[model samples]
Target chain A: MARILAVDDSAAMRQMVGITLTGAGHDVQQAADGAEALEIAERQKFDLVITDVNMPKMDGITLVRELRNRASYRYVPLLVLTTEATLERKQQGKAAGATGWLVKPFNPERLLATIAKVLG
Target chain B: MPSSARPFTGASELAGLAPVAQDASQLPPALPGFESFQRFWDRDNGCWMVKILPGEYYVSRSEEAISTVLGSCISACVRDPTRGIGGMNHFMLPQDATQGPNDWLDPAIGLATRYGSYAMENLINDLLKLGAVRERLEIKLFGGGRILAAMTDVGGRNIEFIRNYMTLEGYRVAAEDLGGTQPRKVVYFPASGRARLRKLRPVENRIISHHEQLYLDSLGKQAAGGEVELFD
Candidate 1:
């Protein structure tokens, strides 16, 4: 079971994610925004971090930039979860050090499958 | 597999999660009376986009209604029932977001031209051009949610300003659902003089907040020679 940090501004999305990831035996922690997620990340370790691209204070792309700068998180699996599916946006995330991209409104099966593949 | 899976064994992050977990647990009780969540999110949005800023309004003679999602921002739907013409306007507050508390009542910053006074006058003027009789205008207002949720009660101020404006202007307000914590999804039909409002859930509120925040952020960036695009 992987310890994953799920970051998004939506409470419902976080709860849905909490329910899904917990059901899969993974320890899930939720954060409201990138700034909050960064605070939690600094204090604890996670196997992977899933963050939405659009958020207040700081965005996911900027978060990936900051995380990648840290030596301890240099190779951490950072995934971007968002509704934008344009190639340019995906490339932007990839360029910003995201390991993979997951679309929003994701179902439990799709979310788990993505995590399993990434964690593998 | 990437180097990220190198098995760094560590303790759970649950120890310091009391408040965070409490907030997650308190996300508004299964959305009491809303329609199916999927239905609301996945409905056909084939209609025209009617998003307006502080001093903009769109009056329509077409049968279709103009829709907008509002936060602490307020929207007014005014129409003449006899002529079947109406419109909607969305405004953030009486003045610019950057305005200070001391400048709250700055008369030098004309209220009619700004969102507070102009937003209503603009919509009323548009309806008049589309054959609405001045004496038969019926107004309906929605929004004024505590979206900022900060120490400053801007939403309450906005609600009060609009109420007083209508009272002074002497427009007959047929219906109003104002001032609550939830952002609203409103559809104002110009031809039928009908209005529909849905008190959105937190997830839906996040969508609206994100959109407006980006727009507001863009305004700041644009003044400094930066461009911010609104994406769906």
Candidate 2:
């Protein structure tokens, strides 16, 4: 089981992601936005980070760049999950060191499969 | 496996969201890819209004009211009264005819709860992003009328699910008008936190029940699973 950090402004999204990952036998922690997520990451290490792009305080792209700047999370996998599917946004996330971009309305099974693929 | 066979998941709520209304030229441009919603100026209420159908929710920081007609479905009117940011959602428990009516405690019922959680969470999340304080949120519950007598008491189940959700989430409900045999027309002004609701007679308005039933049926028919590539 991998330790994952899930960040989103919606409590429901966080809850759903938490439940899905937990059910798949992974340990998951949650935060409501990029700033809070950064705070959590400062305290401990995680195998993966799944975050929504649009958020308050700090967005997922900025968080990705910030995490990349740190030594511990330099090579950790960061996935951007959001409703914005524009090519420009994807390029921005990619430039910020995001490993993957999964649009919103994600399937739990697909999400799990992606996690397995990445962790392998 | 065919994607169509997958059951509806909470994330399905994120699909096809768009601005609502016919006079697209009159109102502000539709929010990006959201083309399925309806928004218009309400001369009656003297404000702009957005009407959301089932499986949709709307949030606003501007001075506009959101409206919807409900039968067996539920609409949770949530807002941070201090921030003048609020929204409404219209959703129902995805019905599987195979599951018996008495299976309220069945583990399968988690599907319903998850769907409800998504609806509630999305609205509240947007409000928070708009600077609405979670602690200062005042919620008003409406709809969930038992208009569908032939089917299971979906309305009652919705009420139970929403009530349990609010309690667990630690959000206080300011007022609620729920669970009866009649449909309702609810107009909620998120800016002022004022809700105007009117009960519509069951006999004359079969459309409410028909529309809600169709929505529930569609949810069951749609496949909620899909594949996505994870670019390295």
Q: Where does the lowest 10-residue lDDT sum fall in candidate 1 chain B?
A: B33-42
Residue A99, candidate 1: alpha-carbon lDDT: 84
Q: For residues B147-214, could you state the per-residue lDDT of candidate 1 as single tens digits?
A: 75578665677787777666655666789999888888887767777777888886676667676666
True contacts kept of each: 0.00, 0.26
Backbone clash count, each prediction separately: 0, 8
In candidate 1, how many Å is residue B98 off?
Answer: 7.0
The chain A TM-scores for the candidates, taken one by one, are 0.95, 0.98
> How far in Å is the alpha carbon of B38 misplaced in model 1?
24
TM-scores, each model vs. reference: 0.45, 0.76
Is model 1 an incorrect, acceptable, medium or high docking prediction? incorrect
Candidate 1 segments whose C-alpha is farther than 4 A from its true place: A1-120, B1-56, B94-102, B106-113, B214-232
lDDT of 2 by residue, B3-89 (tens): 556443321223532223335465643433335567776656655678889988887766778999988789999888787778898
Q: Candidate 1: deviation at residue B43, Å? A: 6.9
